[model samples]
Target chain A: MVQKYTSMAYASADDLVFGKAKFPVKAGLGLEIGAGYTTPEINYAPRPQAGKSKEKLIKEYERITTDSMQRMVQIGAPSVVLETEHVEQMTNNPSWGGEVAHAQKTIMEEYHDEYGIKCALRHTPGDIREDRDFLKLRGDKYDLLMESFEQIAQNGADLLSIESMGGKEVFDYSILRNDTAGILFGIGVLGSMDMEMIWSDIADIAKKNNVVAAGDTDCAQANTAMFIAGGLLDKNLAHTIAIVARAISAGRSLCAYEAGATGPGKDCGYENTIIKSISGVPIAQEGKSSTCAHSDVMGNLVMQACDLWSNESVEYHGEFGGTSVQCWGESLAYDCSLMNVALKTGKEKGLRDLFTLSDKYRDPQGYVLAYENAYRVGQAIVKDGTDNYLRTKNAAVECCTILDEGIASGKLRLTRFETKALAKVQADLAALPDNSDQFMSDCLTKYKEEVAVFRPENYGL
Target chain B: MLDLKKEDIDGILIRYNVSLEKEMTPDEAAEELYPKDELIYPIAKAIYEGEEDDVIDGLKAAIDAGKNPIALINDALMVGMGVVSQLYDEGIIFLPNVMMSADAMLDGIEYCKDQTDEVPEPKGTVVCHVAEGDVHDIGKNIVAALLRANGFDVVDLGRDCPVDEVIEAVEKEKPILVTGTALMTTTMYAFKEVNDKLLEKGIKVPFACGGGAVNQDFVSQYELGVYGEEAADAPKIAEFILASGDGIEKLREEFHKH
Candidate 1:
């Protein structure tokens, strides 16, 4: 039987019902979605080939765009948000005024008519370096943004998620505060923020305008508090929670994404995860995506992500040969790490209930690990290798060692990363009589032995 | 065949840089342990690998057979550490193997201490640790293991060491070199405190810093700092101090410019 969305999906008040736990009770899982739009890095593939004809170019664009959109949808995602671009030179240099209008009209018609889904036209408010660039607030350049939003809204655009600022600035700028009000039907904040305030404001603004309100932050548990605080609509909260929860739990947020940029994806995709996850409310983790080169690599990644879901409804992001896994994994780790936070915050049950709902509707394999048609297997492995291996193996090894010793020593059984930490302390105490080197050797041996128990029977012939 | 006991292999790794294929016989293992020409190594790995049928008899027999203990220690054990160090840098060896090799090397060192008439002074005292908030200490542990294998006195602070404790140890011990390994951006900042405080008090202990989150740019940017590119680089850094007559400034001048 098809399952209905959890009551948490519809419940919102001072007494928030987050998964299994009721509010006015204790802390529950916190989740935020909103990563600002980022200009595609200059180096990604499918970028403009140096020498290509209009026909070839159009074909490539269509192939990439269609595949990406379909991948987004298959992931149970409601929409694919693209970096805003103009019909710079569409087939035959048609009139700028006429072409953009025509493009918007065609896009709206195709989204609802052909795909039975919605599309969002996003662009920089200004030159990406400039603040308020996308809102059409800065000089004449803002005209492009204003016109695009107007044309899309008037035509068939379902919702608009504007990149308010970089993750840090989103809280400070309060982009949803005033200036852009009434100019658009709905608004979403992309990037990091003070979650508690952001959620209250989103709720207030969304209610005032009679439109949906949403915002998202990076993988930090503090950031997720916004969602728990009634920061976004049900649809937005659900989607954000699932994506953030799964990413953090799997330890995907530790790897670096953008080259030369710090804090992993100080460049792009990181912020996009936040924004889209928040804006696509009630969708839960459906907004997350992972870009890799093949299916198997991303498949393993999706499985790992599924393991991270506190709410049985898993949230993951998959793309084939699209972006860097280093960036993707870092964000994923960040999401996975937040799961414990969700549990402690009293939302583990609600999140788990949502997972149950999600699992029934989708098979584990059906979960989206690729975007479009191309599948990336090996591409993501190395990307996930460095940071992912460091964190995951550390946890896994620690866990096994702790469990094995606890059993041998006749201690009560425990499961969870915390058990590993606790078991380590106990093991250390037990091994204190040995010299440091011997102790370390014993610890490592015990750890390996314990970990071997969890390993598959056929591992490493 | 590449099959071999992990710990026995661990010994050969300490005494010689060579590794055995799985499942080799005692004779074959001995042959693999011996040299072909010019006798660069003075002892065979067989003696070290041999199991004791009678502990007292085995020791007496080996001595009567004129197997030099120091020669065995230098050839089989130190050589193994050198090989392990190289393998570690090449990523062919991991922390556990390096550790096992270090342990074997230490066993040889302890044996030498017991057998010799006069004990040798340790190469130098070096302080090492992973900075606070940095839980990944495998790198630091590897550095300490290698340093110990090479005869330096290593005071390992283990993982998540605070800056004040590190500074107090430096002030009291005045170790020729104090190293901090941090694999997280958040934790790497503490190294700067250690570096700054040392320079502030006019102390000149060369601070060797390196790990995943740390880049050469960040290390060189700090005062009295030398960037250790790999765990193996620790011994090389220690060598500079021993050669420089405990002059940390001279060591830093030669190495920190990079």
Candidate 2:
């Protein structure tokens, strides 16, 4: 039986520091994450040409893994986590994902044996539900997805992760209109239910295979908001709403841990910081180093409390400096080295404070991502942890209060437009009924008629 | 009442990385970011401030003073949104501000439409959808909104739309252009499938594909594909398609920054 977190794992947020966790996970040749030192987690994707055939895909994986491992050894890297996020084609063909995982893990093991470099292979298969109907998680596609996970784990994957998409149809609709109630239902309630079901099965699979079910990411929900709010894609969503959506996503992502998966959690889930504070699990975070893949405002700030520093994902192709994976891996390794040096010198908190203060005043998203603010949000999340709705709602309200205080104290700056948007978000979140049942009832009645694809049965409402 | 402690003040300053002597008030920081203008300033202010009622009042007053409704939309409302768009580009304003401004601008447009007897016709119709298996549609929504604001009719297929649904919409709507967005590498392949099916049916309605996962290299690989670099670029691309023929090669040459 898997233990679930019922209360805050640490006595205080101050006790929650980088390179340490209440429950550190050991994987692949004595490489421990969240123990006492930080490690680089390098995530890379095969080039588009690899999609030609399974053999080609496997070859590409081998090349990338060998190249990355060789580079790590050359740089005298302490340890690394290599994550293989299977594409749609690989997941559709479960053996393909298994073959790739086996190929990469073989190389990783070889490097560990020959060079004494600690490494772990994290296999993240694609969520194979082609349509938005996540409720129908039983079909050829669903079976293939589950089969891919089993094969990857059995084929030598040390860690299992999936960017699961549930309640996203409603989340998309609700976030467009900045509807707080719809967000609460979609991410908090519906999303939590789906995570429980899927993660419970995944945790069982991990246990059976002697692999760790690392964690799930709210990439579809929180990352979408983060991407949009970062102003690269669209500006129709506000950073204020994005930060709140992130807080709500923390409750949903927490369901994965509750279902028995341990840390370090996925890197892209910006909500991972708050989850780390709550569950006291190791968390992998990506920011400035991930610019090769994406951009965000919290580049420096998100690094404040990360155990596994990652480069998100770089496509395995040649660059001016080197191959994409090698160059980005070096970037991530250097950042991890800096953090490790700080940890060794007992200046980790000083470095963490620098990371926090550099970007904390730049954006409200950054402001809330600061370790202290993340701890406050974590406190709100656990305050009503039993109820998904209340915990997520409380987290959102807490984030808003943090932003308000930051703005009030002139620690953070915002344009008039942003100030107004923040006010609107606060007002909208505050307007929701305090009772979870009332909020659920109101959302069911309102969003059922409003969001066209939000089926009550999908969430088992 | 003023219980000021030196350590407390030092702690606050150190944590925030701000000196008490040089710290600016929130109002002082906001003062420089606000847009300034004369005739159209109030309407534009209403747009950036996201005050819909204020926008409507300003529109009604401008219309009462005998300004052209169409010109008011172009000069006042769109201009107001333009300020927001610029502020957003400069990082002075954020997404929420843009969303509220878009709402206020749309409300102003609707009010203007009601007041004017002769409403201008839209440039053309465009079908927009997020790619199959991808639920992120805020980018698509913004694209549709920008297209509509630029006087183009948009048939948004919403998020996670099936390829068959998109093909069916194209068959029925016969729009001048089609757009798809996908936020994941796994899901972005759906764009290629949609393009292939559209080509199989001999429906080459210039698909403008973009999102976080998509780039020019991916979009340019297929026929009738144009990479939309930003949501704001949607209107310009649509106008180009309306004026110039739907030549995918030319569209890719003109757009697709990378």
* DockQ score for model 2: 0.17
Over the stretch A167-285, how does candidate 1's per-residue lDDT look in tens digits? 22222111111111110101111111112222333233333433232222233221221222121111111121222222222222221111110111111222222211111121112
Highest DockQ: give the candidate number: 2
Write model 2 residue lDDT over B9-112, tens digit each, in one string: 34433422122222443234344444464556678778777889999988878877878887888878877777666665644544545666787888888888
- Segments of candidate 1 deviating more than 4 angstroms: A1-461, B1-76, B86-96, B115-117, B243-258
CAPRI docking class of candidate 1 = incorrect
**Chain B TM-score, candidate 2?**
0.73
lDDT string for model 2 (A1-461, tens) is 43445577777766666788889999876699899898999988777557768998899889999989988998999899999888777887888888898889888989899989988999888877645533454456667778888999889899999988777777876776667777778888888888887888889899999989999989988887777666422344667788888988998999889998997899998998889988988999999999989988768888888999889887788999778888999989999999999989998888887787667766778788777788889889888888888888898899999988987886575655556667887888878898988887888888788676666765556
Name the 10 consecutive residues with the lowest summed lDDT in model 1 chain A.
A22-31
Q: Local error of candidate 2 at A441, Å?
A: 1.1
Clashing pairs in 2: A238-B96
Per-candidate DockQ versus the true complex?
A: 0.02, 0.17
Put down candidate 1 lDDT per residue, B1-258, tens digits, no spaces.
012233343332221111221244323443544544223232223222322222223333444667555554554555545555554454332343445446555655566557656555455789998886454554676688779867688998776787888888888877888999975444577788888888888887888998754767677777677888667678888987777665645655666545
- CAPRI class of candidate 2: incorrect
Q: Model 2 interface RMSD, in angstroms?
A: 8.5
What TM-score does structure 1 among the candidates reach?
A: 0.36
